[model samples]
Structure formats: structure tokens, C-alpha cells
Target: MALFLLAFGVWSWLLWPTFLRNILGDEQSWSNGSPTAFLWVHVVIAVVSLVLGTVIGVLGWRAHRANRRS
Candidate 1:
């Protein structure tokens, strides 16, 4: 579920703006706005961090469970 949310969030950041642009033309609209370079970099970081955090959390949880069982 977390992975799915992460993927969705990433895809939304990447494609949603362009999709809105297509519907509303080049000019800014209520739905679709052009993304700045800074925004793109931020989005990438957000996606990466989400995935990395999830992996780290899972590993920690597994280790904790193993220690309990032992």
C-alpha cells in the first residue's frame, strides 16, 4: 500500500501537470500549470525519499521481528 501510494504520488507529479496543460492549452489553468525545473527536482527527491524510507522501515521492522522471535 505504501509502495502503491509512492508510485501514484510520483506519477502524479510527473504526468498530471502535462495532462492538465493538454486539456487547457499552453496558458496556465486552474488544473494544469507548468512546472519549474526546481519543482521537477523536488518531485524527484520526494519520490526517491518515499521509496527509500519505505525500504528502510521494512528492513528495520523485519530485524525487530527476527530479534523478537529469537
Candidate 2:
């Protein structure tokens, strides 16, 4: 579980930034010189996922270290 969480976090870290960059660059991401709903929604999702992934990964890492110490 710890390893899984770590891997998930890593994957999120690797994926979200690139995904966001792509989303921002895509013509469909904007409308009339402003960002579209699609862009906003994806931005929100990416931010939430990043926060959750980091928190979960940290918890998992702490648990793993605690287990090892015992």
C-alpha cells in the first residue's frame, strides 16, 4: 500500500504538469481570449489531485518508516 501510494504520487507529479501544459496550449482550452470551462475544470482537478496525492504519499512514507523502525 505504501509503495502503491508512493508510485501514485510520483505518477501524479509526472503527469499533471505535462497534462496542464498541454491543456493550456491547446486551442480548445480558450475561448474569446479567455479560458474555457474545460480548462478551468481540468485545472481544478489537477490541483486537487496533486494535493491529495502528496498528502497520501507522505502518510504512506511515514507509515513505512514507522513500520521499519518497529
Q: lDDT per model, in order?
A: 0.54, 0.87
Using alpha carbons, what is the TM-score of model 2? 0.90
Return the number of clashes found in candidate 1: 0
Query: If scored against the real structure, what TM-score would every candidate get?
Result: 0.54, 0.90
lDDT by residue (tens digit), candidate 2, 6-52: 78878888988899899899999999999999999999998998998
lDDT for model 2 comes to 0.87
Clash pairs for candidate 1:
none
Q: Which ranges in model 1 have alpha carbons more than 4 Å from their true place?
A: 1-32
Best by TM-score: 2
Cα-based RMSD of candidate 1 = 8.5
Q: Model 1, residue 52: displacement in angstroms?
A: 0.5
Tell me the lDDT of candidate 1: 0.54
lDDT of 1 by residue, 29-52 (tens): 332456555555555665665566
**Worst-scoring 10-residue span by lDDT in model 2:** 1-10
